[model samples]
Target: MSMDVTFLGTGSAYPSPCRGASAVVFRTEGDCWLFDCGEGTQTQFMKSPLKAGRITKIFITHLHGDHMFGLPGFLCTVSLQCGSNPTKQCVDIYGPVGLRDFVQRSLDISHSQLVFQYRVHELLPSHDQCPEGEFKDFLSLRRENSVDPEDQGRTIYENLEEGSYELVADEQFTVKAFKLFHRVPSFGFVIEERGRPGKLNMEKIKELGIQPGPICGKLKLGATVILDNGQKVSPCDVLGDPIPGRKVCILGDCSGIVAVGGAKLCYDADILIHEATLDDSQMDKAIERGHSTPKMAAEFSNLCRAKKLILTHFSQRYKPQELVTDGDEDITVLKTQAQSCVLFGQDVTLAEDFMTINIPIKKNN
Candidate 1:
């Protein structure tokens, strides 16, 4: 099994000649999923190996324009491509409450018709304090207008009711979502690949006089097989220890490390992709703007015991090898501070547009 992550864009709020915007693509099991779709993301996709049609799902962090502007155009392109084919593709979008409205309004204004099917699922925070207040307000408005409340819109997808913790689970992997602290409602995602079964020892099987046949299939399935000689063979007799899978944590724009569910979501992550919009010198500015600096991101990685950290979402001010003031002292810094803060063997990296990271599964010793 192969798992890869491609960084489509790495800039925050603005686009530069070097960086586009915020977008990340995870490809596994022959399917692709997008984290955020910023402006010019479709153009960035054209430069990478990913195809727009392969995107089965998109998880938007927030309703911010920079993180979601390219969604409408990308969806339109996917719809156009699928129209020529007989099979119609479907892409499900998951985001905050206002996402559905934004997409609907964009499509309506542009007069864009989609041939493919798409569904929007509104993500509700698990620990919502006043959920009933919003519902009551909606009901009150509907009653004042003398219209059927049900006629307003269909409740197609509700992540809260369906258990928002586990976003996706299958035989191959599982994806989980956690709330993050941001100016607006935002979320972080964790994708964990399921551990693979131990490799079969072909030499041991041959030594046991077991021929390669259908019985081997049963053994692979952990079923005890009775050979032609009436010998019972267990899978453990010819299988090595199981190999551990990889864990990846992708965080949205966050001001600080959220205590609630933050540690759990990122605990022991193999790769933690975090937003580092500012350097250590601009810590106060980062907090004011609801973003994180590189030092803070490194500390968060240390707190979560993450094995590796990939920092992204850089501000446009810093260029490669430009001198900047860090407190009273002046220091030359690169476009991104790709410095390593080793904590229990953890390393840090600076993400660049179109950079691909291939995550490999580790075998048991």
Candidate 2:
């Protein structure tokens, strides 16, 4: 089984010649989960080979125009193409406050109606006091709601909020949400492959000279039973301990440091997807914009001990070779530095629209 990430749009505040706004799709089990939807995202989706109708969830990082402008168009286009009821399942929109009203307004004004069902789950803050000053601009829309940490961390009916990890949705795998440090209230997501339940060791069972049938099922059910011959066996004799799953963390704009406990959520991820809107030389600029530089992205990835780092949300100033002169040596130099940190620091990759990246998980020996 493979879980992969496809970039629908990788541009910043505005669209560039080669880049669009920020959007990515996490594809697993033939289903798609979207993160952020910038303008022209539907066009970008069509360009990619991923099935447009497979999208089941849309996660918005913030209410920034660049992050959400394409949503209305994308939804309407999907409705037009799929004719409303593409599938029986509903498309859930998870985002900050005002998302439902915003989408509703767009639908009402455009006279667009979706064929499929939709729901909005908004995230709220803990108190009236602001946690980060960066979020001041977005308070008007978000202050009306609040998300309980306990509610955010529970997975599959089991409450895991006691630990740093909490489950989001789990079937074959589990998805978790961790709050991040964006200028607005935002959350970073972690999708992990659920570990398979331990199975009875067939060879051991065979060596025991036990006839397999309901006995095997009983053993798998963790029940100790006496067989026809009065022989007793325990499930512990055959089953193994539960193993951990592959972890991938997706972060929006954040300060590289662990100040204010915001960085605690991202610890020890296998892959960290972070925003790098500026270069190292523009550290002050990054701070001013409440964004991160490429170096800062790398630094946070390292801080989290993330096995790999994927830098995204590049500024509109950057251009591919021979495209434009708006980009300078500092931008190129910072990119090089990011790449060098991994192998030559060249491990840092600049993303364009429609680029897909597959995370490599360790194979069982």
Q: Best-fitting candidate, measured by lDDT?
A: 1
Q: Provide the lDDT at 66 for model 1.
A: 81
Instruction: Report the Cα lDDT for candidate 2.
Output: 0.68
Each prediction's whole-model lDDT (CA): 0.75, 0.68
lDDT of 2 by residue, 1-365 (tens): 66778887777787665787888998866668888888878888887897667788887876778888888888888777788456746777776666766886798799998887676666542222124544443335432337553332212221224222243565755665555555555556667776654757899888878778988888887789787778888887866654456776776555443232334555666667888887777889887676888777877766666766777887877666566564333345556767655532224666768888886654432
Off by over 4 Å in 1: 126-164, 226-232, 322-340
Q: What does candidate 1's lDDT look like per residue over 222-323, in tens digits?
A: 889888898889999988888887899998898864444666667889899999887776789887777888777877888888988888888866554444
Number of the top-ranking candidate, with TM-score as the measure: 1
| Model 1: pairs clashing at backbone N, Cα or C within 3 Å | 320-335
> Candidate 2: minimum summed lDDT over ten consecutive residues — where?
151-160
lDDT at residue 280 of model 1 (Cα atoms)? 75
